[model samples]
Target: MQLKQALASAVERLDAADVGSPRMNAEVLLLFVIGADRAYLYAHPERELTSEEAARYEEVLAQRATGMPSQYITGHQEFWGLDFVVSPAVLIPRPETEHLVEAVLELARGVQRPKLVDVGTGSGCIALALAHELPDAEVYAVDLSAEALEIARANAARLQLDKRVRFLQCNVLDPVWEKTPDVIPSEDFSPSRGTCCSEFRDFDFVVSNPPYVAFSEADKVQKSVREFEPTMAVFAGLHGIDVIVPLVEQAHLALKPGGWLALEMGYSMREEVVNLLSPTMWEDIRVVPDLQGIPRVVAARKQ
Candidate 1:
């Protein structure tokens, strides 16, 4: 079968299965199966696929039809103009999260050798991007799930940023947690063992794209996300503040005076998330909306 015919068939199947962006999904999966770019696909539409290639295309199309995210099938996603490795173990990095990164960069402006931490760094997109942009900064990424950390570490190595960031397995900023040993530690990295919030403090910025979806709102989430993505990386709790509450508390404790905390939240979470940042402890609180005008990032400066 020709590339065009296979793509048409895949698109029809995906559309029938009620997948969003069926054509785009079909094209991505086809490109993955054939190991070709969109340019090649267009330039060689009439080219015939071998039996193995056709079978592989059918396999991936079936996966997409079942609502498995294309990023998982491709094992890659682009964030902040950088390619990242992703999997079912981690939440797929979204474009909206880039706003969170931008908000942190704005907060870090003019701060020399700023120390930063990324909570719930599923794919390490935020931490690595910050490291890439701020070559002199100290960056750390922490996640509750060891499986997710594996993928994040892999992405760091893939981006040739293995030495630029530290990965730790911890929930929020738990007082006692050990750093993942695979990642090379910086010369100034202290403790080299389990540590407390005392050692985690004095950051110039604490940023995250944490799980903000509440369990009650599970029905509102897309089927693919609810079904295929890691549950810990999706739902926070009954009120969706289970993760955010502690994250806010730890960020407040971990940040130096005047340090900033930036977070990416759900469309409905601006008010609730903002409320978590107390007026007595946090100031200059602001909500940053995405291109669609949804409140995507909430940032606050420590008082």
Candidate 2:
């Protein structure tokens, strides 16, 4: 079949399956199969698809028709202008999360050689992006699931940022508090560093795009997210603050005086998340809105 004919057929198939952005989905999947760019798709309308290419295009279109995200089918996604490898193990990085990165960059500008940790660092998008921007900063990424960590680590290596960030597998900040030999080498520590916990408490920033969707609101999520993405990276609990509550406490314990904590939240979580940061423990609390003017990121400084 010709390129234009296959694309038209795929778009029709996706639209019939009720897929959103059927044309875009068809174009992306087709481009992925042919290993070409959007310009090639339009310029080579008469180009014939090889037998293998046609079959592969059909396979991916079928996946999309079943509510599988195009990113998962292509095994890739772009964030902060950097391409990242994604799988079922990790949540596909969203564009809005870039606001959380911008928040940290703005606050960390004055700090020299800042230390930052990304909590629940799925795909290592925020951590790697920070490392890419703040060349002198020491960045660490932690996640509970080893599978997610594997994908995150691969993205780091692929981006040639493997040496820039440390990938740790543990529950939240637990690995940072423990005196693990593999986590923090002895030579990396300073004599003035206090207790085991204190040794890792001088982070200038803590950033996250954690799971903020409440279990009760699961039905409200997109079919692709609810069905394809990792569950731990989406739903928090009954109230959606289950992860953020401890995350705030951990950020407080992990950050140095005046260090900042930035997190990406749901559209309606501005008030609830702000309430989690106690006045005594937090100050300069600010909520950042996305391009849509919806409350998206909430950042605060440790008191």
Worst 10 residues of 2 by lDDT: 181-190
What TM-score would you give candidate 2 relative to the actual structure? 0.93
- Candidate 2: tens digits of C-alpha lDDT, residues 246-265: 89888898998899999999
List candidate 2 stretches off by more than 4 Å: 176-199
TM-score of 1: 0.93
Candidate 1 C-alpha lDDT tens digits along 1-303: 999998898889999999998899899988998898999999999999999999888888888878899999999999999999999999988888889888888877899999999999999999999999999998989888889989989999999998888887777877423443343333334566434345687889989988888999999988889999999999999878899998998788788999999999898888888888889999999999999999999999999
Task: Give the winner by lDDT.
Answer: 2
Positional deviation of 167 in candidate 2, in angstroms?
1.0
Cα deviation of 264 in candidate 2 (Å)?
Answer: 0.8
Error of 2 at 298 (Å): 0.9
